[model samples]
Target: MKMKPLGRTGVMVSDLCLGTMTFGTQTSETGGHRQMDMALAAGINFVDAAEMYPVNPISKETVGRTEEILGNWNASNAARRGDYVLATKHSGAGFSHARDGAPISGQTIPQAIEGSLRRLQTDYIDLYQFHWPNRGSYMFRQNWDYDPSGGDRDEVVANMQECLEALQAQVEKGNIRAFGLSNESAWGTAQWVRLADETGAPRVASVQNEYSMLCRHFDTDMAELSAHEDVGLLAFSPLAAGFLTGKYQGGSVPEGSRMSLVPEMGGRKSDRVFDAVAAYLEIADKHGLDPVHMALSWCRSRPFMTSAIFGATDEAQLQRILDGKDLELSQDVLKEINLAHRAHPMPY
Candidate 1:
């Protein structure tokens, strides 16, 4: 459980961040609390949530339930409220369940922070992130046919300036300690960094994006941006939505698995995906490593990784992931992994 600096904020967070997307839905409150205890015992000091969470199948009825569960934990452990770093997101436009699908703007920053603070039962959020760009994003498998030609340049920059000004106000108000982004592009992040430099707002500390053995979109341009800008990546879906666990191989969809609940696996399922999985699974088998551990270890080895975010539907699964928390890949294993990547690139 090595600690790393979260960009330029001077805040040290665990290399592994506990993800709570399934809280209040697949996992009971007791289970979520127990998982937190387990994570803390294992030295994980970072946890992440979103306002539109519990999202295997997001619904209007369950909006904000995850934050409420976390709030309960905070109340029960009031003495240890300062023990961990908390991160949450503001849902972007087209999320119908929140704010009637409104886009993020200067006016919405304080309102969203107030709601998160009340629900989290905390004085200030360690990291407050925008769930996605209001103009739109290429994340969540949307990059295949993405087009950037429709955006108005002047309007985008103006909105960013306004939002940065509002975020600066929130910093003064002690509502949030740091700011971040998710599902954003290299160009978008560059603009935010430039604006924050000029406006004296909270500099972007991190960006949460999907990175795994099967998904390596962050390895190129985004990786370069992180190297120079100091914006570390909080990697989500490091297991490729559980595909790297080999539970979905041979066309087998286990009962109550993510595939069973959402058949498309968030646009990750395809004929090439299984073959790619098989290749990596073989590499793990050859080295006598658990595929889950291999995938997670590989993510942590990246130069731009701040933390690898992982979630479990049950305590047993959580414990299984924690078992390999100390495993480090050898240079030989890493070499084979690079070869594997060349053989099968972009399976999703």
Candidate 2:
């Protein structure tokens, strides 16, 4: 439960951030409250949510319920609201439910922030992120045919400038303190950084991407940029959507789990994913370690990682992850993991 600086913001955040994507859907409001209480009591001071959360079903009705649940907690525990760092995102285009599928622009920035602040019951958001690049991203199983060539460079730069200016206005108005990115590539992040620098607006503070033992795309170019530019990574799905937790082994989809709720598991479900997960689970077992611990602790050990974002349906699952906050992977274990990655890289 140790704290780390979030980029160069002068703000300290817990190494383990409580992810609330399941707050109002798979997990009830009571269960969500219990999870938050346990995480805070156990010294976790960071919580991440989104405007389009409770995402197993991801319906319009339930889109912002997760933030609302957190907002209710903040309102009920006003004295403790300042004790934690609250982060949420503004959903980009393609979801007809959010802003009628409008791409993130100057108009949508204020519109999204107002709703998020209202639902979160907070005046200032600790971190406000673009859910994904409006142009598109290679994330969520889109890497195969991903192409940014179709986008207009002039239009994209114009949008970034306008959006960054709008975000700066929000900062001036005390609605949001920081800006970040999600599901972005190195090129996409670079454009944001360049625009921010040229405009004297807020530099991108962090990038929340899917980084797990099964996913290593961020290890190369993104790692280098983060190291030099101070845009730390808020790694989401450190467990690879519970695949690294060892619960989904043997092709068994446990009832009430994420896989059970969304069989495709947001495109992480594939024929090759299980074998990749098994290899890591074997390495964890060989080292007499819990797979969850090996997965989470390994993320913390990374040089440019600010925090590992993980969600839990209940307190037991949350405790299982928290117990490994201090566990460190031995060099031998790390070597084995790397060897396994080489054997079956990009399983999903």
Candidate 3:
């Protein structure tokens, strides 16, 4: 696997990042350990987790289980933890499970980091991210009626300055190496950058957002920010939560699948979703490609993409997705994908 620079953080991460949200939920500790070994063996040096994980049924009970699983692996294989770039997030807004839906503040930063460190059984996190902006975000299918009228700009910036200073203190304390943002907008990311730059704190290293063939919202403004500012994209749901994987192609949800657990696939199961999936699947077939491979490779092929965060419930699924790491898309296939995007834009 190839490595990419994580912004200006001086940390090189594998292009393919193993996402651990499924751990301790549909996947057990033993299963998660096996997946970790497989991912490491496959040269995936980056692992992504969150404080509120095991998210198929994200509950207070199973909240930090994913990080605990990674911590256990790190504890046992103490020597190998240093080889992987581990990234996790602080849940913000609407997640009553994490700090009772607390907006991320300077006060919450240390508490959240300490909780994550204990759960992961590690002293330092490679990349720590704000799961979403405290004010709010339009990433999760909220772009249709998205508005940023919640908080005053000065108040938001002051809050961010405080948070960034706290993060910088954590960096100085060697608790977290770098910082990132997720489910954030271009303007939101710019504010983070501006605050970090002005305050002499750590700049945002990456932004983990929903980016795939179906979701191209980041292609315009955020893409420009990423390219110029060196803030890479850690794209989550590059497969659109398996909608692009072609498993739910004909509206038949497979047993023991994520969709079976969360029937709506987190608001992705709309009437137009299958049409969009079919379009991509057809492009894959026309190009003599597996849809899953095509989907992952497409995400990896994007210029702004540093790592594609993917999760698997089983080793077989992990292997299938990993097989596409080296598969580069041809121009004709990309053209067809673009044409399909024009035909069925925003399927979900």
Candidate 4:
């Protein structure tokens, strides 16, 4: 439960952030509220949600339900609203349920913030993030053949400037305290930082991207950017979509598991994925560690990691993660993990 600075914003956040993607879907409102209580008790002061959530099967019907559940908790705990840091995202283009798939622009920033504020029952968001680049992103396993050749450079910069101007207005109006990016690249983040600095808009405080033992995309360029630029990574999917938990090993898709609900595991399933999972599982076994703890601890060990965002479908699962909240990997375990990474990189 160590606290880390949310970039240079001077806001301290827990090393682990409570993720509420499954709220209002896999979890009941009572369960979601209980998990928040448990997280607060565990010293997790940061909670992350998106306007488009409850996404086992993201749809128009369930859009914004997760935020509504969080709002309910906020209403019930009005006195403790300041007890935690609240962060949420604006869904990018192609998210059909929000604004008919409109790309993020100056006009959309205030509208999105207003919706999130109303749904969250909060005056200001601690960290407001763009769910993804409107131009497109390589996150969610889209990096394999990602091409940036089609993008218009001038148009992209212009849009970023416009968005920054709008974000600056929101900051003055007390709509959001800080701004962030998600599923963004090193170059994209660099532009945001540059623009924010030049315009005095809220400097990009953090970048939320998927990072785990099985996924090492952030280990290179983005790692360098985060380290040098102070844009700490709020890593999502640190468990590799539960693959690192070893529940999907030997083709065993347990009932109610993510794999069972979404067979492809968001395109993370592959022959090499299982092989890579086995390797990490062996490392955990050899060290007498719970694989879930190992995966989460590994994420916490990274220099660029600000927080590892984790979600649980129920209180029992959330308790298991909280029980291992303070497990730190020894040098020997870390050395072995490095070796495993070299042996099997990018399994998906």
Worst 10-residue lDDT window for candidate 2 reads 1-10
Tens digits of per-residue lDDT for model 1, 148-254? 88879999999999999998899899889999999999999999999898878789999999999989999999999999999999999999999999999998998
lDDT of 2 by residue, 1-348 (tens): 678888878899998999999999999999999998999988999999999998888997898999999999989998898999999999978988898999999999999999999998888899999999989999888888887789788998899999999999999999999999999989889989998888799889999999998888899999999988898899999999999987888889999999898888888887688888888888988888989999999888899899999999888899998888888888999899889999988988
Better of 2 and 4 by lDDT: 4
Runs off by more than 4 Å, candidate 2: none
RMSD of 4: 0.7
How well is each residue in 116-195 modelled by candidate 3, as lDDT tens digits?
99999998999999999988889788888898888799999999998988998999999999999999999999999987
Pairs with backbone N, CA or C atoms under 3 Å apart (clashes), candidate 4:
none
Per-candidate TM equals: 0.99, 0.98, 0.98, 0.99
Question: What is residue 94's positional error in candidate 2, in angstroms?
Answer: 0.4
Between candidates 1 and 2, the TM-score winner = 1
After superposition, candidate 4 runs with Cα above 4 Å error: none
State the lDDT of candidate 4 residue by residue for 67-179, as single tens digits.
99999899999999999999999997898899988999999999999999999998899999999998888988888989988888999999999999999999999999999
